[model samples]
Target: MNLYYSFGTVLLLLAITAPTALLFGYGGAMATRSGVAPLRWFGKSYIAIVRGVPDIAFFLFFVIALDQGFEYLRHKIKCPDWNEPIRQGSDFVVCTAAKLPLGNAPQWQHETYGFMLAVLTFAIVFGAFAGNVLFGAMRAVPKAQLETAEAYGMTRRQVTRRVLIPQMWVYALPGLSNLWMVLIKATPLLFLLGVEDIVYWARELGGTKTPNFTAYPHGDWRMWYFLGLLVFYLAFTKLSEVVLSRIMARLTHGQATAGGEAQRKAAA
Candidate 1:
């Protein structure tokens, strides 16, 4: 059923968005800690701005801004002759050639484009939070470890790659775990991004009245449908907690943190 398929849609979004966000966050975190002043400023500004703004507002505005931005650039390249203002009142018009999916593209293409936008929006928003977490985690690594690495003739880059990067994750795991839960809860926002995620399908299929023409009509069942979604999310979070707990245990083993200390005591 369409509703069942929407479940996959939500999962696919998570699969794509998680790594992409982590990649963006890693870059931002590295930039924040970079020796170059401008890169550091840019990274700090990115984290502050994105994390400060309300996520719903960003979701509502950024998708349109990004889509229009792409169109504007394409218009310049594809429609140099058309001199009409792109901001004619509230409408954004562009040449047919400049249309993102093209005017006559299939329905799937339009849906794909919308899904991509939703994924990018999620990545950018969550990435800022991840960057902040990572930045703190990097600082939390013991300075003495870095000193020891340097004493052994390791270069700064070598120290970072071999020592800092490996150890920071133990500190960062808790924050990243929380972020993952937040990301799971935020999947319903795909509806706002024009992606027909589970929430959308739930509403559409659970309504009491059928459309003007429909094969099946039912009583008001939106409550039951939403209840199912609640269960789905609850199970997902529970599973995540189990998996993250295992990961934390594994990562903390033999490290100097409290988790590692506890793990060592248990093994002994």
Candidate 2:
């Protein structure tokens, strides 16, 4: 049952992470193309820096850094009177009140806090990649379309909203679809984020001797549990592929792209 619940955790993370990442990506892409130099630099730097880092290193380092940052802010706010240095050799000390999901908090609170952090980390990392894809997609929109919109007396904002935004999706969908698959595969990394996801539960429950010494001691069932995970992921990827294909087809329909040409020919 715990294993079953953990599977749900994986799904929930993906559900939450996907849209959040896309939102972040949209902002980053817009920033990259902004007329303001600072905004453009920030967007470019965000994409370059995040994409250049190894994901595992970023995951390990960013979570700790983010947690500490939160705790530090809380410590200052909640314990301004305390004089002890927060950094003592290798340890980070803070007031009890500063602890997120405080030391005395329930198990669920700690888990929830960790899950939220994991979600944020995933969004930030994947958003960079999505932003790059979207940046390209935005540029791929026909310049003539923008000119035509302007010729019709549309404002730049109106041209973006009505012409550029609508057309870029056709170019963006393929790259975004690939990113979605990568994100799906990356869900197992949740275990490293301290989330008791399916992978963690699989290893924990699949061991020969249970931590509490189960009545039925089965030898190394890790293989079976992992096999189940494999099947689950495979089915998930296949479903995603089918859905993305349909989406691509829909987006391509009547567009100026080759996909649209082929689609039109098929209908004829």
Candidate 3:
């Protein structure tokens, strides 16, 4: 029941997180490589700080900080009349309207809010790695190719779009493939965010007490539950490898890379 549904939850989180993270990564990489000093510094700081932190620590702290930051801003806007400080001896109180998803929000709204936060946390963490990979990939595009595009009177932006981006993918795919696998493995962190994902259900159901614990009164079946997770992850990664390998081949087709050379040889 819940376990089955949680499988979809895990899948949905990944489906949303992957592209969002890539967008973040792409932006971060672009910023790092920007001509403007401010943009480059911002990008460098984001990559350095985010990548330097432990993922779990970032997840735990950032969610709380982000949630509070939102509420604080909303409190200033929506609860302007309030005279009391938001921080009072370890209690941060705010107006009802300021609460995310609202205090009286439906159960589904609460769950959805948590899920969104989890998605954001995952994206920000993984995107740094993706940014580093993409930045290197962008640089890996041959300087001569970019120079040729410029010699044809192409603007920097035009050269980037026509020459750099088109070719960077070949270099980027290998790193991105590895990042995708890492993202898959990192999905279980959803549990720490109180998302009631597959891992959460597994622990609850496998526990000795009741939450389905009473119904079955099962004795410590966590081993079996986790074993199933092991299988799911292994199979999923294997499938992902096949898919990404095909993508790499496509990107490398007729290019100057070793992969393209090998394909050309095989065809000959």
Residues 1-268 of candidate 1 have per-residue lDDT tens digits of: 9999999999999999999999999999999999999999999999999987889998998899899989999999989999888888977889889999898999999999999999999999999999999999999998999999999999989999999999898899999999999999999999999999899999988888766557786788999999999999999999999999999888887887787888889889
| TM-score of each predicted structure versus truth | 0.95, 0.94, 0.95
Residues 1-268 of candidate 3 have per-residue lDDT tens digits of 9999999999999999999999999999999999999999999999999878788999998789878988999999998899988899999999898999798888999999888888988888888889999999999988999999999999999998999998898889899999999999999988999899999988888767655526555578888899999999999999999999888888788887788899999999
Off by over 4 Å in 2: 210-212
**Candidate 1: where are CA atoms >4 Å away?**
210-212
lDDT ranking from best candidate downward = 1, 2, 3
The prediction achieving the highest lDDT against the true structure is 1
Reference-based lDDT, residue 206, model 2: 89
lDDT value for candidate 2? 0.92
* TM-score, structure 3 vs. true: 0.95
Backbone clash total, candidate 2: 0
Residue 75 in model 3: lDDT: 91
